[model samples]
Target: MANAFYKVPQPVNEPILNYRSGSPERKALKEALAAYKKEALDLPMYINGEWVSTDNKVAIHPPHEKKHVLAHFSKGGSDHVNAAIDAALAAQPAWERMPWQDRAAVFLKAADLISGPYRARMNAATMLGQSKNVYQAEIDCVAELADFLRFNVQYMTEIYQQQPNSSPTVWNRMEYRPLEGFVFAITPFNFTAIAGNLPAAPAMMGNVVVWKPAETQIFAAKLVMEIFHEAGLPAGVINLIYTDGPMAGDIVFSHADFAGLHFTGSTKVFQALWSMVGKNISKYRSYPRIVGETGGKDFVVAHPSADAVQVAVGLARGAFEYQGQKCSAASRAYLPESLWPAIKEKLVADLATFKMGTVEDFSNFINAVIDERSFDKISSYLAQAKKDDGVEIVAGGNCDKSEGYFVEPTVLLVKDPHYRTMEEEIFGPVLTIYVYPDAEFDTMLEQVDSTSPYALTGSIFARERSVINYVTDKLSNAAGNFYINDKPTGAVVGQQPFGGARGSGTNDKAGSVLNLYRWISPRTIKENFVTPKDYRYPFLEEA
Candidate 1:
């Protein structure tokens, strides 16, 4: 019997469940959080479908409540990374040879698992471990992660269906082959969806992966491993590691079989890795494919006609959600002189209403920054703002690390558009405002474009149609993900297609077919229907 050609259901985004005080979702989540708090998980490195333990360990804690011990994971070293690469190389041929439909089923099943049974576990883990509130956790851990899995399965089929046209006398077929060797996925700590998508995206395209996640994110990343295993992903397809990133990069970048890097992290590390790869370019059997999405100093701009209430809400939600740790979070703003007063008033009121504490409280809108390093960095910026003559701390400037790494959502008003806070990426809940005369909106737009090296996400708020069109056309290269009247953060998987250029890493839009294409190499096969008795071809005949 011929194999059945199956079509996956079109993926719609998972809806965020409102965890209101009396709601069922809230009660269930509260119970899950409480249960998780009492128990500490011991995580082992995953290799060749087996749990491997090591003497080196790192403890993970909730960023909002730093003293609470959540989990500890076995740390990987060069030896472990080497073993992982070997295992992935051994598994690559078999995994790639499996039928495409069969491969699609595994990821589709993983989406189902995330949508159903694994929902609570994923959300709760992100809320506690990553210090996101209930709503933020729901959107990232449950909704976006499931969307990547579901949509990527459909995308894989789409990639397979595309083929070249052929003439009647001959047949042309194209094969989408996995890369010759293994992919190394280096993930960041900001998003749970990214943690799941980075490694699985490559593996879904039939490439074996040696995955390493940020230490702070191991709690949720380990859960992602469980979901894939339950969905019947075969052994050795994706090997998860915990280790020093530099050490792993040192070994993997120089290896003969190193085929690609699937990464989302800081710009500094990505650049360092790129340099190392360049230095060892000749050592590899084939040139490695480099795909990465890195840091951004995103912005929000208000025209004279913009609404103060909406602008205030956008800045609050965009800049403070998850403590503004997202690469797409708004870090700078350009406001008209008249609009600044109202925006300042409304933003201060909104900041006053925010309840800051642990994620266990559903009412708290803000949480702690990621770790001590992040805390110190943000605090240093606040200190500089307080001391410098170029700025004023308008809304929030409090920092308390007695319990958790908490910094108040701060705003700085700058006379100079080129101030350091206006250009640098703080990666926290700090926004710099530069006010311009109402006549200088165009000039301000240009200044906003030129102030920062990064161009990841940005937004423009204007009710005037002409002004909107003007900014849209003028700031065309300002951001990869541009917003109309909305916030730059919270990009839906299939909708916005997130990425950026300039100082940003390669604009490989994740959650799209472009990103998946990186993991596959194409081969063309042609056959002639007619065979000639003689070996002479038409080209051999004299004209």
Candidate 2:
């Protein structure tokens, strides 16, 4: 029930050369500038109530232009992980015992901190560290972080204050208690907003947290912790350790106090974690909740009546934004045969107009992949896709990683919807297009359901009155976050909860008020205004 705030000084901006010219002088200048940038913004893991950097470090290259390397992050290990978990466990009692209003105060203060001047630095870190373009980084990392903080405060307050109608003889009250111990968040690199919400949401609901963000995105995650501290959250309320998945999983599953996991990553990784949790489910003191949003083979459907410009813009941005590294990126497109040629032509024309470069490059529309591993995986998919029968690489499949992990925005036309490229979650800037014959809508729907084991998200584009309602009804369970004329990646905090079921994940959307429900155990508290001397009420006694 105590608080303290630290005022973080704003970072001063300095001008640096751009990536347009590959001249040796410009290259040296950029490298030197990056060294200064690293010195200016080196971040560490927040463990055991302290900010500490690790001995091991990992390099980050900006995805926008690939002009220079970004800051190196602390590559924390098991020791760091255990230390953080210990801190969270120690802090859980005090945090949980605090009044809900006090807890809600921290969230409000955090929202204020995010919306203040510190937002610029958070935005910059997201842009440089993850190579997100301005709009993407600002919305996901800055604006959305604030939104999550604010929404959860209002949400948890209402939840804790819920009351039901009561007769004169009896009174009933509801209580929502945090999980027995610390909740752990294992997040991905795609959305910095998630890195903020996954842990904060649980903590705001009276649970402590241990977060293990992807190593590549540690910088952005670290900045979020600073905001938490600035908001006057007590030390040890939330813990962060930057470690790889397997090691982190070992720590999470083996710990007796581990309560739940809020995860976002590949399907394979989620499966492994799911299996690990299952192995210990019986032996644990208490059952831990499992919530995840994994890989997605999301799609975009365009009807013959769809607008050419609208379809073209949606497809291009949804396909190539963040270099298509998002789980909800539109990897597959289903076009009615009547609109196939027109859609393709418009898409090709718009793609040609896109500019590719580093985050600082104003003209660049697309950025680099997270690292070489992703670069190799995406390139390999493109290569294998080229040799496959009944598939045509349409728009862009060129890859140039001589400088950084870069792949061109690629489009493939599949002769059959069952092709591997069309079915799998490629997790890159590669998209597969399928042309369906007219009057085969039902068949196409069946094919879509069968081909995609992941139903994380999908979109439908049509103008007819019945079309919207029909598509919504048919694809009701197809996606956790569906779209009519929007991209799947920009799911807001309060409006629509994000996440999916099936192979996609357990469908616990991170930003929704519903997410807090998963981290807590609801206990009903009943008070008898007058003693119930008799055994039961008339209905129960009669039965």
- Cα-based RMSD of the predictions, in order? 1.5, 6.0
lDDT of 1 at 13: 81
Candidate 1: give the clashing pairs: 76-242
Q: lDDT: which candidate is best? A: 1
Residues 115-145, candidate 2: write the lDDT tens digits.
5655556666777778787667767776787
Q: How many backbone clashes does candidate 2 have?
A: 6
The parts of candidate 2 lying over 4 Å away from their true place are: 1-41, 63-69, 532-543
lDDT of 2 at 45: 84
lDDT of each: 0.89, 0.80
Q: List model 1 lDDT by residue over 407-431, tens digit each.
A: 9999899999999999888999898
Candidate 2 weakest lDDT stretch, 10 residues: 8-17
> In terms of TM-score, which candidate is strongest?
1
| Superposed Cα deviation of residue 426, candidate 1 (Å) | 0.6
For residue 171, what is the lDDT in candidate 2?
A: 82
- Stretches off by above 4 angstroms in model 1 are 534-543
